[model samples]
Target: MTSLTASESATLERAADAPMLAQVEQWAAVNSGTGNLAGLRTVAGLLADAFAALPGEVRLVAPDSVENVDAAGHVKTIQRGDHLHLRVRPEAPVQLLLTGHMDTVFAADHPFQSLRWLEDGVLNGPGTADMKAGISVILAALGALEASPFAARVGYDVMINSDEETGSHASAALIAELAQGKTAALTYEPALPDGTLAGARPGSGNFSILIHGRSAHAGRNPEEGRNALIAAADLALRLNALKSAELKVNPAKIDGGGPNNVVPDQAILRVNMRPSTPDAMAAAETALRDAVAAVSHEHDVHCHLHGNFNRPPKPLDPAATRLFELVRDCGAALGLPPIGWNATGGVCDGNNIAACGIPVVDTMGPRGGAIHSSDEFLIVDSLAERAQLSALTMMRIAERGTV
Candidate 1:
């Protein structure tokens, strides 16, 4: 592990605790749900102001158009709020990418909108753990790094999008573009409460199958009616049965059905699939296609499948493993307890960054738990601990020119 100089150590030590937590409270108060465009814009403005403390050019880049399939099988376009991009020292020899998201799983109407102390050191609120606190950690770390003498040795591009929770449809292109030519990346996703990081992640795909059939009155001409609901149920069952050790299939929801007296003409099946490797992802896709074809032929109904694996599985390649080791070393130097990592079923933007061929250590944020739930909480002390860890890691990488 590279050692920190006296000046660098002092700068890291000055990353105050009270101010960082205060910013967390300020940001968590606003509801920046993935679907809340207006609220996301408000949060974007707040983040832009806070991140302005760094030496860079910060701008709100407009989101790209994304498509979604509705219950009726029509493709609709969605417009998301702008993503925040900050470019600092792009001309430096070593360039790194830092990413985070401003959106949360909670909606504007969600009941978990306030922040309060659950205990002496635990703060509870929506987005507090899921990522508002993580963003604060990123900003605080950057602020401390800028105060150090080696700040000019490295340059980084920060991309904080508003559509991560819903799949980064709008900001995906931006992430790929910024990640190009960078040596490494750091993403501020909150760590598990135990400080265990997520290592390899499975690739996920959400599918919506729409079945179309002929409707008829049950009492008048029951035999002439083709049951779309029954076909949808059959498809769901087939998908559920496809689950195995490598691939996990979940039939999340079904929509469209009417009175018992009339045979329903339309039905929609929503399903989620997770594949642990590239080969598994390929096999899962082929299996899904075959299932859809069989169901269409057997039920005599037109079936349409929508959605693809947005985030590919992030494997622990040699480069990624080296990056994790660097983080572990930094953690040890900062007096943090031994850090560990494990593969998780959940997917995050790290998968996308890895897809760009950039080695990334994503969950370098504060310790927190119960994300995506009303009971989510952030450990108050981890704010400063994680900031020092990230800042020191960045400084080490900048000095060494590689991990």
Candidate 2:
């Protein structure tokens, strides 16, 4: 394998510290929450401009757009008629895919849409660490590659899905299509605070359980009432009890109840589950069915559950292990720690891409903490470093021609 020489290494260090911060600052200012259609278009415009500047042909895949949620509760594309694809030198055998999402956990009306700086180098903002910064990294890395001598060895496709924050319902097909013949994929999810990547991720699914029962007045005929809320409570306990080493089930929210004078007739429970493997997922589903069946039988109320797996688990394969090695070497050359990874129960767009048989490193973005909360922040230094690492890794893979 070829390595970056002394001069190349110096160039990489400078590239990592490039003026990419300004670009990130600008992009972070835009709130591209998945449910925000205008925001999606706004970010899409920026991406279009960037891709247009590159020596490639860019096309919009989604012809029309709508709003929807994926199983993961990330803001997701409800209906997708189009998507954007940037293609350069497609005839090249060493084609790579670089994917990311523009949506964040924040909503259009979310107060957290504003950006701020924390102590030292942490910059807090909605979607900053989750990924707006990662987009900037891609641009910067591409900029560097455009100037590098080995640019000719690489051909790439960049896709920024509008609905990744959600389960990527709209973009799932597009991601699969793009990965069909690619050598590898690089996803720009935020790295861990310590700069570790994700080696494997458990499959995730979202479920909504609804309960129905006849209502009756508490004072007039309490015994005549069949309480749906009671049945829901029973189901929730049963679901929660299913948690173990292989599966985690959470009945997260409950909605619907009436005045004390009447027995509640309807209830809704929202649950989320993550399983380490496909078999674990099946077990969880069976357990859920059993719980609902038992509750319905005892309470004489109707129960319904909706939703299933959005993205399957991304297990590390030989191809992924090879990609990880390349990334580790790049990190070491950049004076960072050895590239390391751990399995996570969390799901991302990488899961979607991997489901298509494309080996990928999902958390290749910035390093930060407290994502999806008020305390979320981005490690400013990670902006340049991760971007440079990604650019170098892509160039290296292109030269190696995908094992």
Candidate 3:
């Protein structure tokens, strides 16, 4: 029921709009958060059905059983996989791959598992804004293309993956596997409220530093105690100093400490760093190690650092710039407002695909705000518009052959 301006029609995939919205509402009702195997399977079944109805052959990649440790050190393997090679045409080589994550940040026990109409046109739900809506956009746009002559040449692979919210640990290999040799990829993630898509994203890494120090009673034997907390504070200050204009280093959380009266024997500092480039990431790594060494030696405390960068930066290469310009032209053709974007500090699956050398538009979903929060909601009417833009871009690529 979201009303749109007259110009909005040109930007929307009118053919598949209604059905896609229905499908999104349906999928959103099913809680397929990354950890929910049963829900993921159920949603995958529906995805299989939809893909089967598409123009080309449909193949469901069997769900993968993956074991991982939780924050509490509990062991469990999540069920995951993808709907693969979901589309192919007779015209040219496959030029694009469409990827989405069926899993959301919400869990099965989360209270926001169900969907509801928040206003005249706005719908509120756990996954609706973040991605179920984006999935619908992907399917509906592809469905529109399938009914057109563009279907003959614009071959595409649609991968609805599991476990994207958890850094794509279980499916990173699959993402890389499918990205190989593709000209471009479009990922289904919510767009900015003004409908700006993602451009460059920083390479992110997580770090944990454990500080060990001697323990002794404060009053009885103060000289014998090597307070680790002091060393950890020094380390935190050094880390905070690493936040330059090009990179960000955050000492987010701290754990493992002792009573006030007794000298603290242990302290653990958890920090995250986001570097603008791979070299910046390396420099940050060196700085981190140096900070630990300096603080440890200066305070006579033992320290350990662990963890690594899971996703590299998605810089704006020439190919990506061309792809972005092409998308802008497609949007203009659809009569939408000028499409522009800037680099973001956040990271997404697009980084993973780009690392595999695939040009991608990761934030291709409907314009929305407040993702991963209770306030999240999509611009209900923008759904079809964004889908149309994607469909048109693919068609242009088909007509012109690799822009």
Candidate 4:
């Protein structure tokens, strides 16, 4: 059903012929979790070598330093793995940004380490669907693009970051930098199990609230101490109550409480907030401040809040809508069923790209299901299917000059 010129068909056939399954199997074997520095470095090298075949200047960019609050209520610098970046034909008139993450939720020592054959054509493994396949798809599509006749007229930047699972704090700046002056962006986060794309994404904010109180002996001077643990627990409850129709709050963990005989002197509360829109994000922040003030006053303690909403809400504006339409048309041209999208609460690098005023279609990867769990898998055949879709979409964009 996909009608194309002689040159277009040849280029796309090459893309579909890539050894994507082999590539994904190899990449998924390595544990490149956000906290796995050594593994990440190895995967980054492999990706760099693979991307080098795409007519570009390939390099590994060091991640920006990020900070975090430890369970001891002390701020510490967090080290992250480097990202693989490739810029091709920057001087070309049409520029685009393509992004993917090399990190997964599984740690280096996580038990979900080996790939297993769940059934024919379904391989269960960590990062198989949640993204190793996505990275392979990017390479296949770009490789085809380089071989196409329209290659000289189009340019694109490819970024495979190493810290997406834990929120991509280290690579956020790099994502923004690459998004500037691009016609549109395509992020390789996996499509839904049924192959539907993810449209608008909720903004995510993480916070570490520290509670300081006077420590006093239990029985002897219990009344003299302002229990920090109590205050932290109360704050968590108050934060949860702030959730609305457009905002969801989750108080994930609380750290720092010891020696039952002594009143706790300090405690740290970690919470997550997701807002569906920019206005919702702002309102959530204001409500958070108010809740913190009330808790601090009631418990007679000093409260210090750190962190802000890093990933802003990605709503479908006019430009984003146009990009989605183009992708849908490309899918139609590829003989794929009707392409549609729905908003999801999960966040990814696409949120960061959308914040830069660029149109982005995230979830342009192979169809799969149950990511982040040992059951994660890639719908083996979709690898080539999605690559052809992406290749055709880029070809159209290059020919049309815009989304």
Q: Locate the minimum summed-lDDT window of 10 residues in model 4.
A: 1-10
Q: What is the lDDT of residue 22 in candidate 4?
A: 94
The 10-residue segment with the lowest total lDDT in model 2: 66-75
**How does candidate 1 fare on TM-score?**
0.97
Over 310-385, each residue of candidate 3 has an lDDT whose tens digit, in order, gives 7888898999889889888778776788889888989878998998988888888888878898777877888877
lDDT scores for all predictions?
0.90, 0.80, 0.79, 0.93
Segments in model 4 whose C-alpha atoms lie over 4 Å from true places: none
Error of 2 at 38 (Å): 2.1
- Structural RMSD, model 1: 1.3
Which pairs clash inside model 3? 64-80, 66-77, 67-77
lDDT of 3 at 266: 80
Question: Deviation in angstroms for 57 in model 2?
Answer: 2.9
At residue 382, give the lDDT of candidate 1.
93
lDDT-better candidate, 3 vs 4: 4
Greater TM-score among 1 and 4 belongs to 4
lDDT of 4 at 257: 78
| Candidate 4, position 99, lDDT | 97
Off by over 4 Å in 2: 1-3, 6-14, 63-83
